[model samples]
Target: MTDPASWPQESASLAEYGEDCVKQWNNVSLRYRMPLRGFFSKRVKDAAEVEDLTQEVFLHLIRRARGGPIEHVEQYVFQVAANTLRDWGRRRRARNQDAHESFDAEMHQPVTDISPERVLLGKEEIKRVNAVLRGLPERTRDVFVLRALEKKKYAEIAVMMGISVRAIEKHMAKALAQLGSVVDKAGEQD
Candidate 1:
């Protein structure tokens, strides 16, 4: 499989375009699954929502591939993922607004899951990581989420975040530093 951090390469021949494109996308999907998983994992603390968003990411890639000659397919995919996330966030915000208007906060029902302890703990860890994400500067978090977690190329991240590729790299470096500090503190707690 191709490294997830690498961009999609051009097709060797036009006639074999479909095959090459599918192969490239599949390779990327397999490799970048971790990064995509991580990004959505943070964006939506819920496992179910993350799973659904990841599926949407791949599906969007497939649709975008249908037209041919995406000079930088990796960048395109990241852009799509970011845009989709924005839409999801808007919908969630709207729903929350509606809920607030409809019912008293204290009267809200709590969601409960009676799953095994391990599953619950894993979910809790995801929530913690997500909370850490919230503490990051917006651009830093996006860069970190896309580059470290989604394994996206710097060019792709820059395009999605609408900044220079170098900015993306620098943001990633800072984000990693922050993450390391947090991890160290958490370890000390343990």
Candidate 2:
């Protein structure tokens, strides 16, 4: 059986070990904290981030120290700092944080105007185009819709319609001429 009187001595030694560890950490912090800040600040932009990274480096050191004594604390601390920075960069990239831009209403304004006047004009234009499409011969309308709306090549359209390439070209020309006339008339009215 263990002696109960020896328990106090063991507890005292454990307390001394704890104190020694604390003192060592305090010395390491005092010696390298500013240097670590400089190391991070040279690579990182934000002051807050530099400080956070510095704290992260110390946290890594503390965790690693628990496992065993570091032979070269300076080298280990720097390596840990570099790894932390790289990890932070990777996470920032994964989140698209680097691509984020601050919102400025004037700078980020919509490219297209969606005002009432512009919307009404756009609706009217669509109506006019639809009216022209409705007036076209069925084959010509089909060719125009296939080429313009469906984005089919002439050869593809010809194959689909079972028409010759020359015939397809003629139909496209006719459709374009009718649409051109409508556009020209609209331009004059405006």
Candidate 3:
């Protein structure tokens, strides 16, 4: 692991959000690129495109890593990579006219088709949800979105959120309990 900076100022300086960072990550990408491509190609059965997708994954990581702080650098990088794969699945399904929507899309999108009446109801529910999320001691919103929105696995979320799988389960429990009641109540009425 790299040395942790003493302060945000010092850390901020280390922000290599520059050409060098992209180059560095690209090198790393090449190292793992083939194996990763091979692995995904088997399932997706698109060997030719896998290489390009692998490069895209690293490119995205480079962009995001440049934008801001990453609590666990390695973990965050891989999580981003995994999500890229999930996004591919979503696109492919949409292309094939598959009925099953990817969890990835559902989780990323905010509740849509909200009617005025529903919004009024959801207003309080949204507040309650915000409150519930805010009540969470840590980054509950992020964790919840990654798992629920992105449909990312616990291990992926844990790495991205920098929490343990056990902790991720616990956080989701509280998050769902609070938010679920609100959603369930809304769904029950008419």
List per-prediction Cα lDDT, in the order shown.
0.72, 0.81, 0.66
Q: Write the per-residue lDDT of candidate 2 for residues 1-190, one digit (tens) a residue.
A: 0233322332122222224787667666765699899999999999999999999999988888788767656666778989999999999899999889979999989878579987898899989989999999999999999999999999999999999989999999999999999899989988
- The candidate maximizing lDDT is 2
- Candidate 1 regions off by >4 Å? 1-22, 97-190
- TM-score, per-candidate, Cα-based: 0.41, 0.52, 0.36
**What lDDT is obtained when candidate 1 is compared to the true structure?**
0.72
Candidate 3 segments exceeding 4 Å error:
1-23, 69-73, 97-190
Cα lDDT for residue 146, model 1?
A: 84
| lDDT tens per residue, model 3, 1-190 | 1222322322222233223665545444544467567656876655666776777767776677667644544455557667878888888777884565547876788877778987687577778677767776667677787888899999999988777999889888878887887677767864
lDDT per residue as tens, model 1, 154-178? 9988888788988887888887777
